[model samples]
Target: MSRHFYSCPLRWSDMDAFGHVNNAVFISYLEEARIDFMFRLAPGDGSPSFSGGSVVARHEIDYKRPLVHRHEPVTIESWVTKINAASLTIAYEIKDEGQVYVRASTVVVPYDLAAGRPRRITEEERMYLLKYLDDDATGTNKSAEDAEDKDALAA
Candidate 1:
């Protein structure tokens, strides 16, 4: 199993009155990461690939810590958690200096633009997704304690 990592820059505009990143901005971070992964997996060359695009069926997010604006980029790690006939779940973690700030998942259904309906994932798409399959039984790549320890060491 592998993880797709995207380095997202934190903007001053992302912060709210409380001085932490606004909750709504977290979704945009996840979206940017997902888009990067999808583009890497399937370049939009008009081929019958997952790059055709997908619709978000569901989103689940757990904010572990409030992220303050920083010059350093935050890292978003994404991987496939499950793949069904027409949908797949993508798990993500937003981390800075190895400390996780948010954990999330998004269920997306492959969509057909021409037909205006959801469609099954092709074999090629399935195999590509399997490359990033989350094999950990706990469903998380790293424990909170582990992340904290790594962050401490990095500092």
Candidate 2:
């Protein structure tokens, strides 16, 4: 499966008084990357756009380390972790060459803006997401080698 990479620029204002990015600001960064992935890159061939409306049902974040403000941008690697009939989960990692600063996931539900309620994922949306679906069967989020080793042990 392929991953979507978004290079998010760090702003001086994004840092808190502690010289590290504010925890809350990380949410905004995730939103920016999600927008880029779902709207900017989502198919425009008459498919319903997420720009119409979508809500964050949940967010799970693990801050691995502090990220200080820098001139260079940090890359956020994103991929679809789970997709249900009415919602989908997008996973991410905010990282540089050396280490990851954050690992997170957001569960998003499509909304019918005019109807004012959540809607089921359309066939088009499902098909589009399938392209980026993870190949891992266990869904354990482990490295490929680790997963394989586990499978061998289980067998």
Candidate 3:
């Protein structure tokens, strides 16, 4: 399967005393990338989007390597990892120069803004997500070679 990438520049303030990006910063970057991906599946032309509401029930990350401040771009690749009746698990890979720096996953629950609780996945959203659904018959997150530390980044 092909991966989808969203590029973002490293901010000067993202660095820490070690001169490398802080561990927590990677999770934030992943959030931005995931939002962009979800927004693309939203209905309407940016006005009445279908992005009603979603709560992050779980989030976890692992720092495989440190990234230094650089002018070169950082690429965040994300895709659907798994889905259940009311939750969706998304996996993200943050890399530089084709080498991985961090891999993460976020468990999100769709909420019906009016109903005020988790809701079932809509057909449109499911179809969009299914496009990138991981198909590992073993039922483990280690479904891809690049995702060896998959469960380590799960909450």
Candidate 4:
């Protein structure tokens, strides 16, 4: 499966007193990439796309290195890791110039706004997500899945 890539610009305000991007801001970059991948491609307007709605069920992140403010945009590579009946996981890497700053994944549950509840993945949405599924993720997807399962058990 091919990964979707988004070029994310870093804002000066994203930096902290330590001269690096704030830890919390990295999640925003992940979000930008995810929306480009999962929502923007297909229109929602009563279509079988995520723009209709989805919610983040959980997040897992590992900060690998620090990133400072820069003119060049960082590349965020995103792809689907897992697909459950009512949810799907998307993994990401915020990196540039051979250096990785953050690795993360978000579990997203498709939402039925009219029904006011989570909904199952439709055949169309599933097919769309399957295009981004990476079955050879070097064990990272397993770790993400394990973390989600552990969190579920706890909840």
The better-scoring model by TM-score among 2 and 4 is 2
C-alpha RMSD values across all candidates = 3.7, 5.7, 4.8, 7.2
| Displacement of the residue 144 alpha carbon in candidate 2, Å | 8.7
On TM-score, the stronger of 3 and 4 is: 4
Score each candidate by Cα lDDT: 0.87, 0.84, 0.78, 0.84
lDDT of 1: 0.87
The clash count for each model shown is 0, 0, 0, 0
Clashing pairs for model 3 are none
Is 1 or 3 the stronger prediction by TM-score? 1
Q: Which window of 10 residues has the lowest lDDT sum in candidate 4?
A: 137-146
**Cα error of candidate 4 at position 44, Å:** 8.6
Q: What are the runs in model 2 whose C-alpha is more than 4 Å off?
A: 41-46, 137-140, 143-155
Cα lDDT tens digits, model 3, 1-155, are 44568997899999999999998888789888988887787754653333888888998786777799998779998888888878888888788776778878889888889999888888778787888776751222555644645543562
Error of 3 at 68 (Å): 0.7
- What lDDT score goes with residue 154 in model 2? 83
Model 2 clash pairs?
Answer: none
Q: Which pairs clash (backbone N, Cα, C closer than 3 Å) in model 4? A: none
Best by TM-score: 1
Error of 4 at 104 (Å): 0.4
Lowest summed-lDDT stretch of 10 residues in model 2? 137-146
Candidate structures ordered by lDDT, highest first = 1, 4, 2, 3
lDDT by residue (tens digit), candidate 1, 66-126: 8999899999999999989999999998997756888899999999988999999999888
